[model samples]
Target: MKRTLTTFIATLALIALGAGARPAGAAGVTNAVAAAGTTNIVASSDGKFTPSTIVMHVGETTTLHLTSSGGVHGLVSNRLHIPLTRIQPGKAVNVAVTPSKAGTYVLPCAIFCGLNHANMKLTVIVKQ
Candidate 1:
């Protein structure tokens, strides 16, 4: 009876751990417009930015809704005029950007996340 109980407890522990595990390379764009001019961007602990590429019009302001799925992250850009922003697991950070020039801007993760941190970047394409 004791052996059976121990096995049952072990199984439960394994299941609990698996529940929190996320698959690698499972990131995708979450660019659905939440509002009239808002774009959703999600960051994950796996070191990825969802909707890694976005398109914006020059002279038009767009709001980026940033959130983290598994870990704390940060973002900042001098060209885009975005301030240092913190993205937490359960909190949302909004950044408004208006591009004055037409070009492709790469915004990398401001904070080091993990092994895949170096590849984490968001590409913004601005057009007239």
Candidate 2:
């Protein structure tokens, strides 16, 4: 009886840990694509930026509407000319950006949220 109970508990613990484990290369994977002009970005306590990628044309202005669905977060990109922007729950912050060059810019979360913060990033693709 004792061995059976211990085995059951061990199996349960393994299942619980596996449930939170992500597949290899699954970090930062996003299927969402943001259009130009106006894009809405959502931050969460899970340390993720919704619509992880944004596509824009060079010389064209785009406004990023930043808001948090869970915890506080922030981002800043000097190459993209974006200033330090903070995102918090119950509030919205708008940032206007016009990419002069065409390239891919990866902006990581400026503020640390939690264990998954390193995987939190937004990819901006500027096209000529």
Candidate 3:
């Protein structure tokens, strides 16, 4: 029974992974408009950032493709003062951020993920 349960859970996770964004007919946008140098961020229930840290030049734009594998989570940057809160499950939210100064910015999770929420952190480095 335990093995059966594990197999079921693995199947469920696969289903969630398949259900990323809505169909194009539902989202209305036929094509995704991502600007140049925009990093694609993929977040999961592992409390980790796919790229973890990124390097960008001053005034460089990047779009984050925030995705949830199972439950809901959010992206909140304390150093950059940007927050996207209350994200839903099986959803993908996109945001565009540009660095203006040469320094390091800390990015954190806004919504409640789990006990190790504090460790769900990342850094974005900007250079000249």
Which is the leading candidate under TM-score? 1
lDDT of 2 by residue, 15-108 (tens): 9777546321122232334554778788888988887887888999998878776788999999999999998876778899999999999999
RMSD (Å) of each candidate, 1 decimal? 6.6, 10.3, 10.2
After superposition, the stretches of candidate 2 with alpha carbons farther than 4 Å from their true spots are: 1-36
Candidate 2: count the clashes.
0
Off by over 4 Å in 1: 1-34
Model 1 TM-score is: 0.74
- Model 1: lDDT equals 0.83
lDDT of 1 by residue, 4-45 (tens): 999999999999777545322122345444567888889988
Per-residue lDDT, model 1, residue 107, is 91
Clashes of each: 1, 0, 1
Q: 4-97, model 3: which lDDT tens digit per residue?
A: 9999999998887666445323233312443465555555577766567877777767766666544567777645546665545446677767
Q: Which ten residues in a row have the lowest lDDT in candidate 3?
A: 23-32
- In terms of lDDT, the poorest run of 10 residues in model 1 is 20-29
Of candidates 3 and 2, the better by TM-score? 2
The segments of candidate 3 whose C-alpha lies over 4 angstroms from its true place after superposition are 1-35, 78-81
